[model samples]
Target: MNTRSLLHHFKEMKHYFIVVVLVFGFSFYLGWANSASFSHFLKDQLAGLETVSKTLSNKENPQVWFFIFIFLNNAIKSILIIFAGLLLGVWPLFMLVANGMILGYVLSLQTNENTLSIVMKGILPHGIIEIPVILIACAYGLKLGMLVWKMGVQLLVPPERRTASVEMKRILHLTKPLIVGMVVLLLIAAIIESTLTYWLVHL
Candidate 1:
């Protein structure tokens, strides 16, 4: 998309972005306040993920393989979140909250003096790009959910009054460029995460 179109799209989606941010903050608060209780629950929820993370962190895969893995993993997640918007946005919101809570819980666990530095080194390299991309995906998902709701509402009106097709076309128009941008950002994020992040953390 051109700069103007991109800017307009961002403005149009601002409310959805804010919703995700608010939910994230709330989830973080819950995780921080109930860390003792939530920790156990989150542990159970994330057991498989933890195992995979550990394996990845330990293995010294070639950069190309690591990039491919990271990119595909992120791409699938983004697609799932976007598609989940069809469920009236609940799925995307739930996923965002879950992820936020997990992040908060994990952060709460790091109590050592070097924790801040370690976390920064590990996250900052890729997080600056990845986090925003994920948020944008979630925002678009929420927008899609809203569009679906609007379409359903339009169906209740007379055939001449219905605008579902028009809405669908608008959605597709906005989504195509957003998805392309997200893929490009994710590619950069994966490269940074696999290389720069690794080096910084190991240093």
Candidate 2:
């Protein structure tokens, strides 16, 4: 899609993005206020995530390998989120909330000033780019879900008035640029996280 069309798509989907952002904030607050209970409830799932986090935290991996790992991990996540949107958008919403809660719980576990500093250093460098990209991806997922819903609604209208095909085309048009943009952004984020962020944290 051209720049104008891309911009229009983003503008049209602003409300969906806002909804995801609100849901994320609400989930974060819930996690922060009830971290112990929430953590206990999700202990099994969290354990696996913790293991992966620890592995990624180590600086021993070569930059290229680390970059590849990060990029692939994020790319897979983005794709999954978009696909989940096909399920009436429920999965994307759940993923957003789960991620926000996890972030809040992790931040809450930092008990000391030194630990907080270390965590911030490790996250902030690449997080500035990575987090926003993730949010945008979720927003796009929600948009797809909305499109699915619209298509369903249109199917009920008279054949002459129905515009399902047009909606489908619009969805594809928006999705193409969104996927491309997200991939490029994630690649940049992976490079920053693997190289610069790692160096900063270790220093």
Candidate 3:
């Protein structure tokens, strides 16, 4: 990213990071709260079981084929997230929240009975990239969505205001570049997350 883009990104990202830190702190707090509960032990066991199920499911498929599928899915999800931004302001917020909740739950569960280093080795390598990319896409979509609705309040010629065709074409023009850039970034993240990151943790 250029200096301008970098600055713009940080400006956009700062609030989101605040939310993330809150989620992180929340996870740690939840872990402590659950320390004495049977619920904690149960949920931890369930998470482990789910992880094993996922592992077995992966074992049934060739790794290359799985990665190919994951790559396509990542692109599709990014596109949907971007497009969703155009319609609903809170859609991206929902997407980000869902992502955050999963990570939070995982982190909270980690405190039940596992080494921090092991958890980091397992999660952070690709997560460091993948999570932020998802958040960024959601943020961009949120901004775009906000603009689409807010910009519609004023009309230049009353009834002869911007036509649907003109507005849609303009939105497409702007959205194309973001979509392409997001897809490329997501693909790179998928590759690192799927192969390199997993291997680092398990191998």
lDDT of 3 by residue, 1-203 (tens): 33445445556557755664565456445544454443554466458647754774567554555466667767787678767878855677666655555554556555445757656676676667666666666766666566676557545346656464465455556556666676777788778766776677667
TM-score of each: 0.87, 0.87, 0.65
**Which lDDT tens digits does candidate 1 get at residues 1-203?**
45458668788778888988898888977776778978878888789767766766666775656677788989789878987888898888888888788877877777777668856897778988988888888887888788789888888898888776676667667777777888999999999988998678777
lDDT of 3: 0.62
- Distance from true position, residue 40, model 1, in Å? 3.3
Cα lDDT listed for each candidate: 0.80, 0.80, 0.62
lDDT string, candidate 2, 71-176, tens digits: 9999889878986887888888888998888877777777768656856788887888888888888887787787788878888888888675676677767777
| 2 or 3, greater by TM-score | 2
Cα RMSD (Å) per model?
2.3, 2.5, 5.9
Model 3: residues with Cα > 4 Å off, grouped in runs: 1-61, 112-115, 155-171
Judge candidate 3 at residue 49 and give its lDDT.
47
